[model samples]
Target: MSSLLRIVRFTRSLAPLYTAIIIASVLTSVAALAVPFLIGHATDTVAGALAGETPTGTAVRAVVLIAAAVLLAEIANTVISNVGGWFGDVMSNRMRTILSVRYYDKLLHLPQRWFDSEITGTIVARLNRSITEVTNFMKMMSNSFASMLITTLAVLTISAWYAWPLTVLLLIVFPVYVWLTSLTSVKWQKLEAQKNEQVDIASGRFAEVVGQIRVVKSFVRERGELEDFSRRFRSTDATTRAQSSHWHRMDVIRRAFLNLVFFAIYVIIFVRTVQGAFTLGEMVLLIQLMTMAKAPVESMSWVIDSAQRAIAGSRDYFRVMETPVDPRTAAMMAARPEGSRDGEADGAAGSAAALVRSVPGAPVVAFRGVDFAYEDGEDVLRGIDFELARGEKIALVSESGGGKSTIVNLLLGLYEPSAGSIEVAGHPSAEVPLDQLRSRIGVVFQDASLFSGTIAENIAYGRPEASEQEIVEAARRANADAFIRRFAGGYEQVIGERGLKLSGGQRQRIAVARAMLKDAPVLVLDEATSALDTKAEIQVQKGLDELMAGRTSLIIAHRLSTIAEVDRIITLRDGVIDEIGSPAQLAASGGIYAQLLDLQSSGDTRRLARYDITA
Candidate 1:
């Protein structure tokens, strides 16, 4: 998108202030023009009065009135600027809001692997980066450029009226200043763009190190991390210095050029005075007005420079905007009937795959020949198929990089398949609004994203309307109630950003409690116990057990011991399902499942047998 159009669209959200702001800009410009006119009129009127050889009341009155008028215009300009400033702020805020909304919507549409594992840190950098470009444009439009443009025109007009030859001479000289400014600004803007990229990478690196500070300390890798940071920091520093030098160079050239122009004009004006036409006052006022006009033009260069950077920054923003979201099977579909599709087949098979929708109980989750790949074209999940009967629990087991987590992501609609499909309840996963689909499934990942907030708030995140009793019940079910109650403030205690203040097990328990509070028919636990202690693991397992009852559950466990109790253990290898059966059955079959079990046996086979005691 064109930068101007992007800026306009960005400002569209500030409809309330937009009209008032535009008018204020025009008025500010006109008022600045009036300054020279006021000064010129006042100077000429006094000159004429003195020429008449009398201290006339009319001259005195005119001078006072003109002075008063100039004062009034100055006052009005300042007031209008403040009002315009408020509107500028409104526009800047709305632009940021629009950017944020677009960013979040893109996040929803984006395939998971495109971000690799650095998604969270990238997300943090995005949020942390300054919106200086947008804000600068708004401020310049209202406070700087609008009025300055008017003042420039006004000064030139008056200068020509007083002395056309000088005005024309200065006008010829002006474009050189403008051309030089433009050249340097483009170079500076490119440097700024590079600096912006460095800042993002640096900021992302900072967040990454901070997130893994514990590991850094444990491994004594602080020096390594700091050195890595120093490399990026030096790059940022070089770009910043380059940008600063460009502007400084432009300033020095403009100042020297202005001095040369002013000297030429003064020498010419002095000759005119010696030849006996130009007065002392005219030359004095001419110099002052000419200098005043140059000031805005000088500042105008930086304004243009910032405007260029804003345009460049938006390339990243617009690149995100250009990508397409997943296509839906249908624009709309009614809820699927209650009871199994096997009983009646849901929604007449809305395509090859349809989501089940029932009035009561939980949503059924299913994947049909779902194939997916990353942006790099490396396929992660091959054409695989399965159905999670309503309220049935399924645990996913696989060696590392077996696309186990990819399955959970597909079920959650984070990624649509390269071929095949995913269905929720009875509607195609792509067919249902993703937010609505996600609303029906509560997910808890190994590193559960916990925002800085209270335990109660985080637990009830998806279900903001959940009652206090419901929240407490969820905490109790997640095996978090005991530890939570022991805390001084119970549920009111803050979790801190990403639950950094809490233990890994504590965060995991809180995540489980959050999913439980959601009360969705579909629940996901991706390595839910990976971060827990033996005691905490057992406690969390009890909570998971209670939470999974009568819910369609999908679990991804790194340790084989974790999934031994699930209703069905589906083993994945190289993106395809190798086996699907109860743990004991899989072990007896003596395939990948038995091999995995031997690696991480916790002697909990009876406990594993609880969720799926194969009849």
Candidate 2:
């Protein structure tokens, strides 16, 4: 079903509450109708009493009782509308919460290729609008829609009972009113959709400019950036203005039509009264009922328009919701292995495979003859094979785009290999549960994306259950404790967004501390020390050395210095392994490694000496 119909159907599911409110609301309308009827009856009777007919006590008594009934009806109307609004809000909030959680769950289970294909801003846009759209729909349904439907039904029923011909005339005109309203809605919905698309485009441009603000300022490209953003902003504003015009035009047309319709109703009623078909008192009742109905009829057109816009907004969100998630059933056998004595299990993996990894003894991560390509013919990784034993430390060194980070992501099961299979501890990577797999691994990235939060919270990010003392210990391990203590509130100090309040080195060290606190059996250090200062780099390297001592580790590095100390170096070029050997062995081979050592060692041509990494 279409989203508009679905929203309405879902609303109907809360029929018990709404039906009760509607029943009360209709009764209130009936009582209100009686007030005008009583006045008409009293008017006709007073004329009779004045014309020397016996004074009718019953008519006076009827008028007094109807007045009391009108007072009661006003209270009932208020009570019903408020209760309906509360129930609708409750249901809307429930739906929003459910959808929000499902989105995150689906996100984690999605294959790496899917995430790589979509922009981050687009995903954000889907989520941010879901709750807003649901809330808007609730307000429209229970408030504007409920009142109009009840009042409209009441008016038509009363008119039919008193004057069948007039009722039929009014009923016939409603269909035309509805058709015109739909026309306005169609025009407005197109504009609304266009406006939403423009916002997404503008947001993407803003994200790019702000993300690269440092480079823009340092290279004096701020003016160019501003110009690019201005161009995007102009497009956004143009679409917004066009959409605004459509809505305003619709508002004017709908209101004018309702007014014209109202005039026609009155002209018909007046002519009938002059012909003596109805008394003067009956004419007054007709005028009073129509007067009360003008608001709902006019407002109904706008409600229909809003319903269309809400449906358009919900389309993207529901599509994301409907996307399938990976079952990962094949990996279940290795998902959770029983811990052996001393928390170490026997592994079929090699010695260098175990360092800086999460799962002990048995390999927590591996890539076996893994081959990949963005497309069918263009292979990126050719039969790549590796295994991380429970506590092995390994480094991948290569030129730019050499597939070092790709290997790291494969271990994380972000992407499945196209030609070969990868297993985490002898199980197919795709078979393991996503959250469990992630919880077993921790990563320290080059850029070190830190959020605005307390130093303690940042340090304990991976392990939110970490105690205050544990957070402090992890910070001390990365040489971050001294600087953190210097902050005004120490662990309580809040870092600005993306940790802008902290130095680059400080943020990098804190990120390392977070990984350390996780105490995962696997660690992916992707250029972890590439962004730090010399002193901070030394401190971070020391922490990494300790972190790698007993877990599987994969280091993706551009800097030649970081690769010299690994148990073995896997050198890559153009996504293929160039050579794999110890630093001494590769240097002796006098191939790629020897040439690299020659360039990075002093300005001399001789047997190379490795840098003394004090950290």
Q: Poorest 10 consecutive residues of model 1 by lDDT?
A: 338-347
Score residue 484 of candidate 2 by CA lDDT.
91
lDDT of 2: 0.69
Cα displacement (Å) at residue 95, model 2: 4.8
Q: For model 1, how does the per-residue alpha-carbon lDDT over 1-615 read when each residue is reduced to its tens digit?
A: 266565565445456666778778778767666676677677878887889944678889988999999998989888887888888777666666656654554555555555665546656565435445655666566556666666677778878987787788779767888777777756876787787777777778888888788888999999988888788779888788878887888789887887788778778777887776766556656766787777876675667666776676666555554545444312122232221111111122333334445534423877889888876578988878887887677888765677877888788767778899887777777768655777788888888788897889999998899899999998888888888888888889886778888888888888889988888878888877776667777777788788888887888865555567777888888889889898789988987777656543655545434322111
Model 2 lDDT tens row, 256-327: 777777777888889988998778778888888887676666666666666676777677665665564455
Query: Each candidate's root-mean-square deviation in Å?
Result: 7.5, 7.5
- TM-score, prediction 2: 0.83
- Once superposed on the true structure, which residue ranges of model 1 sit more than 4 Å away at CA? 1-5, 15-22, 25-52, 56-70, 89-109, 117-130, 240-257, 273-285, 327-363, 557-566, 594-615
lDDT of each: 0.72, 0.69
lDDT agreement of model 1 with the native = 0.72
Q: Which portions of model 2 show Cα errors greater than 4 Å?
A: 8-35, 42-68, 86-122, 184-187, 207-233, 236-264, 292-294, 329-364, 375-377, 559-561, 602-615
